[model samples]
Target: MDKKAAKILMSTFWGGGGWKSVSTPFSGEDFEYAKSQGVMFDPLTITHDEIVQRLHEIHQDDTLQERVVTAFLHSLSTKKVHLRSALSSWALTSQLPLHTYLERRAVHANTSACGDCNFLRLQSDQEYVDADLNVLNFERIKWGGVRHGWLLYCLMDLELLYKDTDAISEVTPEDQAILVSLLEAAQTGDPKDSARSLEKRWKGLFPSSKQERDALLEIWAAAGLLVPTDKPRRGKGGSGDFIFVATWQGDDGYNTDAALRYFAPYLPEIL
Candidate 1:
């Protein structure tokens, strides 16, 4: 491994920000400093083949974490899953507590019980079954070989979703309008298009508060509806032009000026 890559990984691991916080692990200055030290590596410079090669190399270790990471990376790079659907599912399942079903059972029984007792007491009510299914789905993602970055991304998206719309059950007409407007804007294929620019253009359609609009933009990016522009020079500079990768280190802000492109291939289906 390159020493610079190792250094970057170490920094990312020890860094601070998380799904609950607005800040990122590394600030803009950190990227600048890394560049000055000749240690910054642009993710855009890496090709799919190179990524697969690296994954192959990492798979040699055969460790559980390595295997999980490799699988997650492969799925992401290959676009194996429908991002919009996956995000929606995550948002829905994440809202409920992991032990919601168990708690409901305990409440009904009106007694403290061991794990086996709780399992035996499980009811067949539709609501309980739905809650149990939600918990199961959440657990699968939480402990079933998914990457932490993706998990964090989902959590952050859910937080923003609640903050902006206050519900995850369904997409309202207004939400559909906003999504359509975004799709139309992206269809223009303008290289200068950024979240700030779009927010300005659709000011009437978005929330009045700047912070709320920013939250919505962040949620869109996390949902993979909006992605960093493919313009090579844009992401090359370690400045304010980067996408949210849900990683601890790196740019995490909405980056209103960072050009974004519509990437939801399933938008029409959803709309």
Candidate 2:
């Protein structure tokens, strides 16, 4: 498994990119997430140059592309770690596994995880269909090394009906509406009202109105996005325990469970 390399790859993949978790690890754990791989990097400094360097190293042997993608998707589905960009700083540390997955999938051009990844392929079934792009462009899909781990949840939800990975992103408005309602329900669980909550917490992302705040958090929570973890900001007592979210949509229990499983597979694997 190249445990050390995987740890590094995990860290760089999340921290070096801009992706992190929104939920706090524990009540006082300031960070929303931590890298099991331990690849330390600042998301702010990550650039395409760095990504290209990492990619060159990753593509050396493309056999393990599917494995690497699986590992990453497992992480995404479970929320152990979320990346900021697809450039994959994690690959820097995880040489063997990364190479293994890439080497295997490099030749499988029909659905190569190592190829032009316009969308995520987090499926047990290997049939990939790169069809329409609703919310983002292929290149624009990832920036600052991060984006919402929406595809994982989409795949899981769609898999209930045995759908293909190609059309998973097309999550219907009815389903999204249902998720939004779930987010609204969860948010109301907090003591604060939407107005106060918006002012006190989510000012940066949706500082305009309560509706905007609700909408923003709703999308994140409902879609099961990963906030950041190695964030540099400080909070109460000048400590790094408070994870200030611009907004959070919701994190359905399924994604939360999956996230923990991915990062700490030993727990479920052992049990």
Candidate 3:
């Protein structure tokens, strides 16, 4: 390999931030040994999506799989699987993990042109919402594959999400109210709330039989905000609950600028 190729492969093995990582126990040693053998690929300039596309372009050739995996292994260890194996994995699977799903997106464009873009306007599937959450398990594995930079892209988006500066700020009415109050509390650095306060606030949300609002609140509380900082203190009138109030987007001492920025890009006029 040339100097550039060598440098890229070395960096890829450690996941760019620098260090070997195996997503699963089964991935151990094999990819590492391949690195030692000088196998690597520059996933930056070319993406995993392109790699799959190339496989289709050449798959008709009887020898194509062997040839490509040989090339890939030479750049990064192929282990035992050939290119056909990897490419087939892509073609057959209807979906991938959210990480791979986003990174290997087939096309690049807004909704108007591509049939698959989903307009990226952000919608939900029945029983499921495309909630782009944080990398819940990032610390467990430093990185997963050569497709590392795309993961970086995801992290950057999340950082910007927390920065509260995205233009497409769409929160449900209830979440809006909750986020408003929590943000206000954040400003005061007073991060406590009455026990079961969320339960009370969200009670009317499900008019019918709601199995357990407390349980749902627990999940949100765990994610961040709506948290309980300390035990409730008994007050003057006898023991009343100590409560931390929530502030809203339009309320005093809240920052909605970031939300404006995030939601703006998705707006019809700006988009």
Candidate 4:
């Protein structure tokens, strides 16, 4: 492989920061072996040309290559990494134990679009969202591939259901109160009954009809802040029963910005 490829893969095994000289069970022999082969233990101290030479040496020695790659993978599996080295204001809202998750998970991002200019905004936004989505998918996959099936599902549970800054500001205080009430009613009471009550409560909030009240609720739901049960159950003789549940617990899942910020450290570096 080329030096660039070697460096990248080495980063994965040694971590983005490269190998440290800290004494550990795996460090002693592996460090000595790498140094003997002209490969620096600390990747940060090596030049690209040096990395290329080391990779060439490994290529000619089958046993050495196998040993090195195996040792590297083992070290990576047990080492530590951070999802975010620097915290931002937005990250304060993350409910996930991000650091713990990072320790056990291998996070990667698609860097193909990093410097694209043709459709920069759309591409970058989509990539960012996809990267976060990939993290969630990775957790689920590791937990056996069921939807929300990860044992540590909380790691993927970001508190961003209503964290849209624009949505918050546009939704007035009076409307916010109604939304919260509706959310509680949906989660705790009968869905149909709550709908009626909400309509009644809507009378003074604004002179609006039941349909208008429902429309307002739909608006918030469409804004990704709420989720209503898609399946309707038959109740009694023929009444359709529906349930509404807040997409988030409290203000959770509202801050997409924080989610990205917290996950940035785990992403791939474009060089």
Candidate 5:
């Protein structure tokens, strides 16, 4: 394995900045600027086949990450199971209350150890479910398995962007539709359209609340599906960079202008 390339790829794969327990070796901030522009880990020293092989080896084990990827792919292929519903089914299969299952997988406070009996605990299954869903909305994972679905989604996009193989057979039609819509919208007149304007144009696709629509846009931006026109703007109130929006600051931050354009390179050939 090219350790350097692997580190860069991992950093790009796990969006957001600062340190994360899962994204070790490279601080999550290490590739933040490159990540904002749809930059992927493409090392000159490695071949695409080699990279794909390494990815396969890394995921060969039947870890929870792999399971989540499998389940997500299944959901996409069948079009019958929602991602959240699949997660709920997995929780049910654990034969434990969702809270207990999650708590057991949680890292104990003040220590790197996970599944510690002394860790802060949620009172009920619904509490854990609610909490997990909340963070999952941010497309960030904690306690390993909590947000693996979105993690898998990002990984799939990364693989599709670089690898030549048809390895990832399942493509979410909803996501593809959004991507196609954005591409068409960007090509209409102004190529460098802001996130807010694009969101408004795509509003009908996201039939839910404004919050959900905004969240999806942010997630797509973070995943490199949408490229920002400029480097991430520093927040006025010391709130960190604006591209990979780490917080919900309404429209004043990343969503204010049409700063993002369609990342053409990321549009899958399969489309």
Candidate 6:
């Protein structure tokens, strides 16, 4: 594992900046709810670096390692990493067993972890789904690259697999219609068309409240499916928004074949 590459990928995968945890101080009702879950949760400032660092600490007791890895996986399942966009990075230190899990779960489709990125296959079991659960095709998912000693996703693009973390956990058929419309418009019009305009035109698909819309859009941006374009104004501030761009055939690098093979099924409707 390339430590240098790992750091770079971590920085990007975590969405830039250093590992900084912001505390979410639970209050009255929230605190009570947390206790019900068996943890007196006082969310603290914990960075990804800290988590990865703990993964490397080889103590005399292997129990500590197990606990750390377990906690890390739990975090992955529950917490939303910022800017976790279509691109992601994974560390390959001796202590972390994630590589083994990825290897075991990888759906090999005549691919390798060479060149720019590495790819993997995920299980379609709905009950035990991860962030990439909605993407039913194994070939569509590809990741590769070794920066320094760390494993990073390279030459890959985004595809809508998960609905994102929010109160709206599932993508209804209506939501699929919205996505289909967006994709159709993107394919025919100028590439520079404003996504904000599209949203405004399809206002009914989003929450009526501005605050809710902003929040939802932020989450969508982080998911890597939307690409933001800058629409410059005359001696004024720039405007525009990210649109749905990454599809089954958009990515041209390491996983083109896989993307082509699998992304086709999602056309005209999002599952």
RMSD of each: 22.0, 18.6, 21.3, 23.7, 19.3, 16.3
In order of appearance, the predictions have TM-scores of 0.31, 0.21, 0.20, 0.21, 0.30, 0.33
- Which is the leading candidate under TM-score? 6
Scored by lDDT, model 3 comes in at 0.28
lDDT by residue (154-229, candidate 4, tens digit) is 2222111112121122223443343334434434334344434444544554334454444333323322333334
lDDT (0-100) at residue 178 of candidate 2?
Answer: 36
- Report the number of the highest-lDDT candidate: 5
> How many pairs in model 3 have backbone atoms within 3 A of each other, for residues 3 or more apart or on separate chains, i.e. clashes?
22
Task: Give candidate 4's TM-score.
Answer: 0.21
Clashing pairs in 1: none
Model 2 over residues 171-271: C-alpha lDDT tens digits? 23343333333323444333223322433454432113343333333323322332323333222222121112332222211234423423332223322
Select the stronger candidate by lDDT from 3 and 4: 3
Q: Taking the tens digit of each residue's C-alpha lDDT, what string does model 1 give over 6-64?
A: 24433543345522222332346655555454333222233222322333343344342
- Give all candidates' CA lDDT scores: 0.33, 0.29, 0.28, 0.27, 0.34, 0.29
1-271 per-residue lDDT for model 6 (tens digits):
2234233323322444633443334346644543343223233333223333333343334443233222222222233222122222111233233233223333443233221112321111112212221111111111111121222111111112121222123334554454445344333234333434433544554323333333233323322334333423222222423222222121111122322222333344332
In model 5, what are the clashing residue pairs, if there are any?
Answer: 193-258, 194-257, 194-258, 194-259
TM-score, candidate number 5: 0.30
1 against 6, candidate with superior TM-score: 6
What residue runs in model 6 are displaced by over 4 Å at the alpha carbon? 1-30, 34-40, 52-172, 185-193, 206-208, 228-237, 240-264, 269-271
Residue 231 miss distance in model 5 (angstroms): 7.6
Candidate 6: C-alpha lDDT: 0.29
Candidates 1 and 3 compared by lDDT, better number = 1
